[model samples]
Target: MKFIHIDKENSIAFYQQIMSSIEKAIKEKKLLRNDKLPSVNKICIEHKISRDTVLLAYEKLKKKGVVKSIRAKGYYVRTEDFNFDERYFLLFDELNIFKEDLLNSFLKGLAGKVQVDTFFHHFDPAMFSKLISDNMGNYSKYIILAANVEGVESSIARLPKNDVYIIDQMRNSLKIYSGIYQNFVENIYTAMESVLDLLQKYNRYILIFPGHKEPYDMVTGFEKFCREHGKNYSVIPDLKNFKLRKGQVFLIPNDRQLVETIEKCNHHHLVIGEDIGIISYNETPLKKVVQNGITTLSTDFSEMGKKLAQMVLKNERKLIENKCTLNLRKSL
Candidate 1:
């Protein structure tokens, strides 16, 4: 009946000690599913611990899906699996091939008692807020890929600032929070400059930016790169109205437009990487072979994931820029 133990001399926090004791009880078969845990008052009086400490531990277990609290009945063990060191709630704009890499890498990099629940907002601000509101206090950390979503600062402000992390695209409002983000403006500028030699054969540079979910900083970077190099350049909202010509290089952000660009090139009877060049944003394994290789400007998603794991594991409070790289291929 008396399963919980307290060690006040230990350096661990009181709440954490209470959680560890419960986990130890579960692991040793002393606690079973549906078994009622010691009451907060009983725990406090017997162990000389504060009521808040007992409640905090119970709440953490409840959030981890290990314990459930009933109205007037008190807390009971919800499951037999007691491995719950940390829980992370990861939010993304959308799940695509590249983002899949980021997610898988983050998951693979983490070891031990960790649970990651992933969700996507699909660029809907309402869905974004709803997800945050729903999972507000359920996780130890909140990792969000807050795309071009506007007015998220107010929503994120409700969360514990130290526990929230901004990923992918960072916003000015959430700059105070620690994050691992892509430097879109500088990455695009430098990546383009890196392929300047490949660009010399082309007469015009065009960026296919649909401008919906895509970051506007990309446009600024491309514009800056073109102006400094004195290269004739333009940004098109879509390929529906624009005509692709030979001796023109197109920088496409999304794969949909990239495919359209290639199709248009075929209609014009222009050869790729020769008569017309193509550069796409984000790198994937298929990109290496697609269109005889599509030149890509991208950040290392795998490394980003690994670094995020480290940040959480160490409880780091620094904003880190995930390394960006340009993968050169024949399409350019």
Candidate 2:
């Protein structure tokens, strides 16, 4: 009954205004399935607008499956699913500040073309399988962060193979599908190599790796780099009961341990960047401000998000490895 009085003074095209109003109404639930719309002729007369203008709007809506018309029954709401063209199921290993950056960048890149429902598997294989199995047909597409979980290959096999894309971690068993992934082995190796000069300043290099949650490839890479360079290095499970010594640089893979290392430095009265050095994995905003700055070996997560969005929209099937970078600062 209203095009909301088509304002000739406004810059928006009259037909588009009508389309927006209808779409807005559908989103707000003001119009639902089978709700009748004003007849084309009635809109033409009541709004003193051209029949062609009203027809253009209705035809567009019809094409999008938002509205339909019968030979004599006039137009009616076909569906109220106008908010998005598609729905996405996003599964992450866990929600962290860096992961939040990736999610935000992804949503921005998507530009509202689809609705996203995010979930976390927390690196639990059973939970990962259950979530995917339970939401088998709920979403149009599934983007998963496989983490280091086991049996993911079998779990994802039940899904529509073509509609799934792997995110973050990539495994040999799950290589059949497409995705954006991080090459942790090469990333860690190259990242440390990039800072070889800075590392030489310390007498020994140690990586604080707690077997759980961290990829084994990271240890492999760290060991490879250290061994090949003939540098003194050790990979220990954790910093528990560990001694803080001068001329030592700790390569911390997890944030919690990174904090613990820093606390150890404080407890032992060791001055970071002077008596002790630290290099942590993954970049966060606080890393730049904490301890003057924390040297980080990380992948460009925002770029990964943007590229993943493009991959989904374009249906690109290539295995993409996000670029990694080393942020050198006072912490190292």
Candidate 3:
């Protein structure tokens, strides 16, 4: 087969470039069905590159079903239909941008090793159970970045012993395991304390949230901080009908409605959860929100990606739980 060079100094690896060229050739019928690939040594000698490079490229092409290696024979273009899913099981709050980044980081971390077959649909215990039931035997590895263990614990508990690692959230702290990050009540408390430290100066705080779980954690942390600091507070769920009198700070959860409400406020100051802050959770290249600026308590999602890479390489398959950092930004 003939090979062509597009851009030798391109950012992508030369082997990857070669692989792309050959795959494209196959698609275009340049390399007919069952065509034999250039021998690894020959390709290396012709390309003036290392044998490992050519072998690595061929291995990757084999994994994608673009080519296959035959026993006692060289690799050949796959003649049969190549069918496989390319998505992974990603579970997180749909409304949370940070959660999306965290999942992306985990998926990107696994780029070459295994393709993400499909993302597990929004946090549904039954859906995860169904996936495990249907594809457990088919899938060689399963990576889950569970934000809430209690939500889907029972469902995931039944899967076969495959490589499993929790990214942003943890199950419990008693056991030693590997993870990209950790989540706990302490971080929640820290987040609340952060907002309260600001609220104490103002006296009244407005709290907005999409649901009760995260808010509940923040409230526990905030109230605990307030009680220790000799301050009294009240929660006003009705923000529209409610009017801030004086010296009151508003702590809203990361929600679009709450975001719009904060935007409309003229002089009123706003604060989000101190723990599990929205800013701390954006772990992907995709930006979740375009805000003036927002403070958050988040974890290093790339580290989570690194940990995932380690787990997949080491074949680490255990339920891991981790948390995020209290990343502070200026959205408040």
The candidate that wins on TM-score is 1
Residue-level lDDT of model 1, residues 1-332, one tens digit each, is 77777778888898988888888888889999999988899989998878888898998887786787887999888788746666789999988877888888888878655888899899999999999987776778999988999888888888989888898898677789998999888888998898888899999999999999999989989999999999999999998877778899988899899888888888889899999998888887888887788888888888898898888878899998888888888887
Best by lDDT: 1
State which candidate, 1 or 3, has the greater TM-score.
Answer: 1
Which residue window of length 10 is worst by lDDT in model 3? 273-282
Lowest summed lDDT across 10 adjacent residues in model 2 is found at 1-10
For all predicted structures, in order, the TM-scores are 0.83, 0.74, 0.56
Residue 116 lDDT, candidate 3, scale 0-100: 57
Model 1 worst lDDT window (10 residues) = 78-87
User: lDDT at 313 for candidate 2?
Assistant: 86
- Model 2 misplacement above 4 A: 1-82
- Residue 188 lDDT (model 3): 55
Model 3 lDDT tens row, 202-307:
5554455445334245555556655676665555554566664545554554445445554445345433332112322233332234443555555665566666
